[model samples]
Target: MVDESMRAALRALPKAELHLHIEGTLEPELALELAERNGVMLPWTSLDELKRQYAFENLQSFLDLYYQLMAVLKTADDFRDLMLAYLKRAAADGVRHAEIFFDPQVHLGNGLDLDTVMDGLLEGLRLGRERYGIGGGLILCIVRDLPVESARHVLELAAPRAADLIGIGLDSAEVGYPPSLFADVFVRARELGLHCVAPAGEEGPAAYVTEALDLLHAERIDHGVHAADDPAVTRRLAEEHIPLTCCPLSNRRLQVVHDLRDLPLRKLIEAGVTVTVNSDDPAYFGGYIGANYEALAEIGFTYDELKALAADSIRASFLPEADKRALLG
Candidate 1:
């Protein structure tokens, strides 16, 4: 069993939460409250029924409920409240910086303007930096399952907010909709001076990892666990020093790994891949950044190894070099 000192140390490690989805932070309790306030109807009558949906067998299973729950977030205030709640929770977990992910496509489908989504989230971010001292940037992610044309539209729609948007990312289903499908838009995003990141190899193959690297030109891979399935891909990632934001508990909950002990975190680290622990969708998976490090600990990682992962996270963050050096100090 882990000791109290270790637990306290885990809570105190200054880290960066790089893969969080703002929408995924919606707790079931908050979901209900927002539903009532927005006059939005959630089909589930009891909280227990809603909680039951957390048993997601795979990525698609969780996404179905994720999109559904987002119906409650209708206004700027709701978005501000959601981001503030996540920031406070992360701050308590010792997160000094966070590169949050936001999906504007979902809100667009709900008939909301892009300005409402960006303005509300930016306000919350401004307040978060003031109140919590959590410094970070936002990566606008385009849903892969949607049309390439739609992705292009989002990039155009997001133009006015370019200064606030640090990067562009590709997320959502990865199976049939390959990273190559979004190549044009990703190139367009880079031309606009945004960093590139993409979700690859979680449900896709090692080839998909390569596609993300070569085609979409993703600087970092989110949920890149499937790279473990191929030695060559792992070697390339290690040699290139590419960072993989592996969401351990999220992988387990989604049945990506049947046992935490079987996770390839140690192997990836040993192979020289810069691996970082993160909460992909904390509310949907189980916990936040602190909870993720704890889950990885369940497999018997030592203190030094855990600290190394936290440091890797800082290095992998998009923070200015000066800020990153300060954090490292």
Candidate 2:
């Protein structure tokens, strides 16, 4: 077990959260509050009932509940409150910077305009920076399970506010919807001067990692644990210095690995791959970024090794070079 002193030390390290989903940070208490405020009818009556559905057998199971809970977010204040709440928790977890993810298409489908979503999230970011000094931007993630045309449409709608985003990412169900499917969408995003990142090899094959790099021009691979399955793919990641944003607790909670010991974090590190720890969906997965570091420590990562992971997180972030150097020092 990790001691209090060690946990305190881990929490003191300045880090950047690279794979967070703002919607996934909704806590049960806040969810109920928003439901009441927005007058949205949820199937679950009490916070206890809502909390019970956090158990998941797979990615789809989690997403089903994830999208359902989004109904409470009907106004600008709701979105702003959600982001501010996440930033507050992230600040306590030593998040010096955070490139947050938000699904605009999903919000749009809920009868909200793009302006409302962007305005609220940007306002939240402004407030977060003022309050906590945490600096970062958003990565508008494309829901891969939806129609490719919908993916294209969101990119089109996002073009006007491209400057507000740090990057574009491919997320949601990863198996059948390969990176190759959104090749055009990513190309357009690049034209808008956006960085690229995609979730590959969590539930998909290691080949999906290659496709993300080659086709989508992904700068980082999210949940790339499966890349270790192929030496060639792993070698490319190491040689290219492409980072993997691995969420240990999320992997275990989602049954991506039956046990935390089964995660390939050590193997990936030894192979020269740049791996950083993060809390993909902290609230649902049961930990924040600090908890991820502590879990690694519990599994035998040394103090210096954990520190190195913290440095990796800052290095892998989308922060400006000078800003990154300042944090690294």
Range of the 10 consecutive residues with the lowest summed lDDT in candidate 2: 54-63
Give per-residue lDDT, candidate 1, residue 106: 88
**Model 1 worst lDDT window (10 residues):** 53-62
How does candidate 2 fare on TM-score? Answer: 0.98
* Clash pairs, model 1 backbone: none
Candidate 2 local Cα displacement, residue 321, angstroms = 1.2
lDDT of 2 by residue, 182-294 (tens): 99999999999999999999999999999999999999999999999999999999999999999999999988998899999999999999999999999899899999999
Q: Give the whole-model CA lDDT for all candidates, comma-separated.
A: 0.89, 0.92
- Judge candidate 1 against the unseen true structure and give its global Cα lDDT, from 0 to 1: 0.89
Error of 1 at 265 (Å): 1.4
Q: lDDT, candidate 1, residue 43?
A: 91
**Candidate 1 regions with alpha-carbon error over 4 angstroms:** none
